[model samples]
Target: MKFAALLRSAALVTAVALIPATTATMAQVDGRAGPEFAKLFAVFQRVKASYVEPVEDDVLIRGAIDGMLAALDPHSAYLDGGDLQRLETMIDGNYSGLGLSVVMEDGAVKVVSPFKGSPADKAGIKAGDFITHLDGTLIYGGSLDDAVAQMRGPSGTSIKLTIFRPGRDEPVEVDVTRGVIELEPVTHELGAGNIGVITVNEFSADVGADVFSAWQDIKKEAAGRVAGLVLDLRNNPGGSLDESVALADLFLTDGRIVSQRGRARGETMLYDAETVYRGDMAEGVPLVVLINAGSASASEIVAGALQDHRRALIMGERSFGKGSVQSLLPLGPDAALKLTTARYFTPSGKSVQEGGIKPDIAVPQISDPDFALRQKYQTRESDLRGHLINELGIKDEEMESDSIADPRFQLTSAQLEEQGVKDFQLHYAMETLRRTTKSTVALRPAKR
Candidate 1:
């Protein structure tokens, strides 16, 4: 018999003899399944019967798959077979959907940020917007998976969203038509004094090659007269690790890029720079990396490595604290698991989990009048430690900041504001680059 037929027979036999209800469902859906499907069903049955509590079969099945995949490493994930096909499309940086990056925050699905040029951004879906309803149905308490499923649909379909913006007393309504969201990975502009401004959206599969190409293009366009390079990693929620390391290698001549430590693993695994690929760019070219709360994962690795080694000056808000590494494991033919396998540390041996990489100079994004007060306080190590202590009842001594410093890192908030540099962090970095000497710049006190 064919593989599909064998799977169907096995599923029918197991379901009829063991879990009638689950078996019935599997058999009905097993018409096109293969041997792998039968094996998965068998594992699901064993888990349902053996699990401590009377768990829902679906939950048990999903949990088992998740546990299975999480063991490999972080980043690999199992998408539902149908979603899997769509995922392949997404990796290509084009997908038809309502454009919004979302996450489960405080038990509610919140909008992280809307992509530039996306329908959501055009509709004014700013970061910190709380999504309360989808299609006029209350979805605040729903799972993120369910929320995403509801928000995504075929192209040209209209969906109404009720959002709570910070300043507004009442929730605002937005009607957005789903369209193809194409991510422009690298965008460049010629800034003042022939400086090059390059913005990296995300380190997708082709990001390494794309960045190398962009760098060449920038050099060619500027003809070796480029004064400075601003690499904007703001709001870039990371992608491929290989891309991150490869991109870092482009800038550094030598040094450890990043390291990973796992719970059961004996020791941390280190990734060091093997080769320097600067292309046609000159050595000692002044570079500045702009990061923000949205920079994470692979983005953090690059920024942290560069900052640790003093290869580039880092400026902007603190990055998103996502230092844990995840690995995806294939559970069955149709299901997969994405699990946190290890925690990543920068070359300086700092754990970025909960505590993110602090910028050499901090610069806050100006928020709308409504959000000003809420985001007034800078997210500092002490503040994060206090939060952890209060919420988790952990001792203050348990929290620690990673040790990484550059003698030239001197720009602070008060000093920047006092100097009348509204975006002082970036200004300081630019000025420091202009000077181009290995000397520290003293921060002037804020003017009263």
Candidate 2:
């Protein structure tokens, strides 16, 4: 249940405070004197005496700290008060309202993403949409915390969001009723052809144990035996690092699952299969994992580990490409700094920083009626400002597929709707597993 705070760009939640602090020191301690220090002090004195309005010392100091961290990376931040509470809510996995992860960008309130099965997502509010109005009142240039507060209310209440999508011609208004979104970190169901479909909503507490229990239930529900498994990680902004490693260990009986390399000696570590669970839970069963732009951090760890070992065939779109690790350094009792500590790499030494895990089979969500519109507005880690560059220097064009039309998947949205295939990615993966033999499920280069 211990989670290293990994945030979604759209829906930002955090937990980077639990790891052991590497270097404990004062936030503004007396250190080696630098000539720039004098300049900073002079500027502060001038602002205090000559400014038209008086500014409090606490406000100025906090602003200085935030500004310093903000320049480092998008993921590195100094969080306190409401921001700290937001991080806790991510770990708790329960909240009321639109279920949207949002941030302030250029004085505009932009949606990060709607949590899977949340009211915002159910109402079709895609990531990268700009919110200009709330209840028909203009809310531009407002604080992100204020915007998030306005969006929350008692369950059953309704809120209107005026969204302007990037590719759309005009702003669209959506009315969504607030609901208690108690995100069950994991959920599963038995599908046709004795396939067990496990959807990991988040990498929160006890993920490995929950997934193991889910596997047991899946086997019990099967008529004869479990035939295939589909690990659906779509829209799952990652959570606990330990849980992610432990979850990957469940399916990987041998070999290194992941490794972390950082400047500090404490941050450098390697994790293997038996480092967590005892053995592979599924053994010989065919496996397929589904990921998209929302699957990031710890989720990518699981996908990359399974894919490299040929334990599971990764499907769907590319992940969010967030391989950097965040360590929470305590500034004081109430506040802390979430610092980007290290970059993680797969067993094959592939760093998923700007380059996320590429699926073995590139599959798009062709069944959704809004598939085209959603694709036009997709968001990922590479899109976030101040993101660290990958050492390999992979280009953006190479990280994605063209999503071209294939004769094998010629079914249109309308045609698939008539055939009762609501999720084309899942449908096609299940069909592929039902038809193909185990030997054919081995790793194959993606057709990009």
Candidate 3:
């Protein structure tokens, strides 16, 4: 079955609960009525009473809820009771079932990507795989929300997935047993010349404390005076917004970390820097932040704030565009709605909406031969030309000269190849820090 049909099925199921015959009187008496509500009720009632076959009220209500939320945006979604439980497990850094991020695309549920170290990842579930069935049931006619509800369960639970892979004539079936998934917040190591390399996976509730703990550990290992710091934020789909603000304040003594503006809000609320630097580190240290397409929301906030404040040099591909802020609204009876409440801005007042923050230097990843071949065929020089123009906001005349180049910006494909850093974004950051720190030491005054 087609993906669109599945989504329609899910939406239809949720809409049953909101059938006008069952809900209009209560909704109106509850004082939530306006012209929109009145029209919605009329249509819902007409559909429920006019349908030839008897339809369950529960199914209609659920479908309405799903349709309502899905209309808002891709990220804002209505999670059923079971799906909500799974989200709670993810936030707590533990969950069961196939660890894959799936979304309704082109009406069929498609795998966004499998989480690293997940059963789905290990089982070779690739991005863009269309889930045709779950267990013995035909999932092609259901909503993505309902599909997720069917997929999640307790640890050690086994689920079978039938996927339609690209370039394959026949579908593939994979049976995977769920396991407890634990997220690693901070991972640090001492690189060449005693440089501190720290990778922050996500900005969860405990991320602030975890970063501090990692910094202390790295400081001890470095014996003070670490040459430089390479903070890796690649593939980090952001979590807590509050945590991102707090994390940015750790390295900044004074400045507006971030700001938020809503539809009605004329004034922009600013989050200022902490009074003191919590970490025992001085300002003007050589810092390089690594970012890529996966760095989003809170991660983009940190990268943008730091780059705007001149605290760190951002090096990598453009980040994921997710500037909108979401607030969790409790819908009585143990249900909640995660709604997009506001749009965030960098300290410099740039709105990173569809347009993401541009890196100080653009280093295209060409480490893999297969990736290079794909790029050659799919993306020509003209493709990158528009990206440079749009991201830099430069006119065609400005590119006539070579003034756009910066001396500090260096590409590290060769060095990365030598170090076997297929994930070359992080290697580029480390090398940038090493070069910047050497320059800083040379420019420093001699000891008295």
Candidate 4:
């Protein structure tokens, strides 16, 4: 996901090849840290002079930059050349690739989530699966960028991925054909009883407007007033923050949508309702938002807002807990810094960092036969290395809600499939709406 806006900030660039700093500039270093700064330059000089194999200055400098950023957080990184291009392609929502969002987890490439309907998703790649090899080439300790590059090719081309899913004893191999990923950020369907179902794949540009249009189409399809609405954000890895607030605003008349708190002045900002849209578009309609372990960043923003305002019944598992925001700060023509600049909060001042947005009603996807086993390895922000901890400490019990069995979710995957329920979470939501809508002319809006 394209996380945030391109911001400009003052940077400290050190010339690795040549120490070109003037005497005046060199003197600006704080006296307390002068020894540490000297040690860095000394190591650079020693590496260049005595390393057994000659290393390019660019390579050393890039490695240094990467190492520096790597020490910060997983989301922070130095983007340039192919990395920059990939970021742009993601924002444009068109690319010829495996359509997967991956992160380096202790040197292994881990799938964050595959884009909905993409080749990876279609090929049965699940979140938390480790990609050990690409086309038989071992990539366990390889650069994530290189592994990602290997996964992308012209449409119709194919690649083999050796995956290591956590709960499995043996590694699995899958051959997947590449395709152009034209992401449809928002898609809708009119179900039985005029219940509108809108699935937000990601919070890309104009997502809020696209969702609004989808609702209009759903209303048209219904040929009358729509019943309850389901905003499906399951497995959505999140995108543009502006679009997230805009989406929340679509269903809110007034009140704060989200607030971002950062160490910088510009990073601290508040987004409120009525800023993007004037009023609630689906006023008085019952709403249920579906989120799972893959729902993160902007997805959490929307879910948290609607939940805090009592505008929607949040169902499904807890979110990915990515409350931190990353700003794409341009460093040069070909490079930018994807730095974690702020931690965002829900309308009620709750941060979804280590502990994600807890669902109002926890519902498991029992339709997937592997759901029970896969739950053991589902990767959330808390599982990430160097992830930010929530200021308000989360209790272990809060995160264990999913483990507690419920009588309502006893149906097995085979049983659900035989009953024509392809998606248990979605079916459950629609059923909830259907049962609730029977007694009211229109579902009353919750008290704000």
Candidate 5:
């Protein structure tokens, strides 16, 4: 399950939607731009001669490259050495760590969502928890990579995390044992009533193939009586663009899955059903794709496609809006540039830029005790500094709606816990499927 690491960062939808290295032939350098180059050269010379201590040329050059990319966007960065190695590991789908998707919010390490069944998840590390320390050392305002490096250890080793939850006055400590996190990209389980739950954790290499295989196994386990399907893309950061399209194609017999547009011809392309795989794999099964703020790039692509085509009922919170595509350009044998090259659109031509994929139904996770607290501190792509603005110019107030007035969802966490409902969103989706007959599910409803 190797995801294409065409990102400074998240499998939260890193990687180009499609791999197209479109190199434009540059015209002769413009004379008007000479002054800027001269200024940069002068600055370099000044740093080399006047800095407190002399710095290596390679060090300065690398720093300069990073500075340039950082100015562009949060996703763009210069990758080399350890950074490149981490990207490879993410793409290759194996690592030793606490299995958490985290982001830096104003220098604090905030949890995006612990990987499902990962060590961090088992330790009760919920999304929106602010990690203030690792192994007793205060990490506030520290490098995220350094904290991550500290957390990732040989299997069986343990790390202590000090988390500051939003509603709590004090921080809590949790011990997590690192394991050989073999990215189980596609995992399936047959629940009561013969319902199939397929969780796509990452969009790594051959994800489409992996999911198809999972469905085959799921059907077999269900004794060929699959009543419904829950495609859990919750907390799943995105990976490869092609894999996302392929996964969406599994449920779509016809129509466009996703499209990418950019300045280059190669980047502007449309992907449709059967282009990756022929026909819908689970033709008649009712599908409820679950998403949240953690469900990003690649995840959004699949969810958006199925949703726009009325192939699946999208359930859960709005997706982590990361519709921009990144291209991996090799700087040398060991280094590369993860540059934002294009923006993606759903079948209806909706850009996932700032405002992400809004679920057909916004299912809140009321079952979790910390749900209310986490909701207050949750961060999405729009929360990131210098994020790309949506062309539609959506307003912040337009993004969130009031769920408080809804009487049907007034149940407290205590009540849900007592009733043995650990996941309200999933439970609601399952209940919805239980009510929908196979006949109605087979006939794809007219797109709203």
Candidate 6:
């Protein structure tokens, strides 16, 4: 589907919640700042005159812009040319590559998560695994853009990935053939006991509407009243903010969904229930939201809002904790600035910045043999360089709780596999829903 038709706004795009851009009025130049500008110009002139190799002005200027944004935060970036094109492709187009969401940390490319069913995922390239080399060439300390460019190619091509997994003695090598990544943002299934399972792979355009339709389909498939619903947001790195709010609105009848606050007056905004959809679509059904370390910005927003309103029983690991909102400001015809304009808060006025949304029940993914080790080295918003600190000043100890093993969860990967439970977390959630009453699961039923 076309992005414009999906979002109902042609201009808006989704990369951790894209919003409309307002004109930025240049601030009056301060007399004290004049010396800094002069210093910058002086350095530029020296580089132009004394550099060993001739460098284009565009290269130097673009580098300067990149440096400026890099200093701000990990999410803020200057997008142009290939970068812009890639962003568009990621949001709406099919591309040939080992589908992965990655971030550069300390000169190493860290896998955020492999897109479900993509080449990377199929090859067992997991989140928190570091890609140290492509084929035989070392990729450490290289530009992320360059590494990404190298990864993408014509479909049916093969590439070698050397991965460094934490807690492993030796590096692992995997060969994967690049294929077209056609992501299904939302997928649904009607499980046992008339329970519905809706997995939101990403918060792409029309995700909320897609989810609503999925629920309707689930109800029809059950051929009876829906017993429970599990909204799976595991490994979902988040996208459109509007969709997050809209998705939350699906199960909510009234009260606030989320609020964003920015330095600029126009940047701050509030979203409430009943704004996107009228009454709750999933009325009287028990709800559970599944989140994990990979569930970020938009995912956290939905989890937090539902948790705050007592609409759903949040289960699984802590979120990625990206509370900031990125707005795509047009720089020119082909270039744009993806700037972090505002910080979002849950309905309870809590900012999920460095400290992500804490799930009501922290269920470990014991189904994976590497679960414990991967969780040990997992990166979150707090781990990123130049990440915005939570205003509430979260303690380091608060973040450490995710690692503490609970006595209740002692199932091993072998044990789960023997029982045909490939996903222990999802299995646990579905089991919980099967046994729990609606009143116990959700404090407030969605208005009919």
Best candidate according to TM-score: 6
Whole-model lDDT, model 6:
0.84
Please write out the lDDT profile of model 5 over residues 1-448, one tens digit for every residue.
1223443323224754323233552125789999998988899999999999989999888778877887888898876766776666666657888888776678898887787789998999988889998889999987777877888889999989999999899989998999878777888888888888999988877788999999999889986578899999998888878789889999988888888887765668788988988988888788999999889999999999988888889999998899898877765456666788888899999998889999888888888877777788788889888888898898988888675666767899899989988889988988888777755532375454
Evaluation by lDDT, superior candidate among 2 and 3? 2
CA lDDT of every candidate: 0.62, 0.80, 0.63, 0.81, 0.82, 0.84
Better of 1 and 4 by TM-score: 4
Clashing pairs in 6: 17-241
Q: Any runs in candidate 1 off by more than 4 Å, and if so which?
A: 1-56, 63-90, 154-157, 166-168, 265-267, 275-282, 367-448
Compare the candidates by lDDT and give the number of the best one: 6
RMSD in order of candidates = 11.5, 4.1, 9.4, 5.6, 3.1, 2.7
Native-to-model Cα distance after best TM-score fit, residue 315 in candidate 1, in Å? 0.4
User: Residue 248 deviation, candidate 1, in Å?
Assistant: 0.9
Candidate 5 residue-wise lDDT at 426? 86
* lDDT of candidate 2 over 142-175, digit per residue (tens): 7778888899989999999898888779889999
| TM-score computed on alpha carbons, candidate 2 | 0.90
Residues 1-448 of candidate 6: C-alpha lDDT, one tens digit per residue: 2333322332231334444444553236789999998988898899999999998998889888988899999889987766765666655667889998887888999898898889999999998999999988999999888889899999999999999999898999999999998878899999999989999988777889999999989989996888899999998988777788899999888999999898875777899999999988988888899999999888998999899888999999988888888777665456667888789999889999989999989899999999878877888889888998898998878867844668878988998899999999999999998987856946564343
The TM-score values for the models, in the order shown, are 0.70, 0.90, 0.73, 0.90, 0.91, 0.93
- Candidate order by lDDT, highest to lowest? 6, 5, 4, 2, 3, 1
| lDDT tens readout by residue for model 4, 345-428 | 998899988788888888999998888888877778887788788888887577666456699999999999999998999999
Q: Lowest-lDDT window of 10 residues in candidate 3?
A: 10-19
lDDT of model 5, residue 329: 70
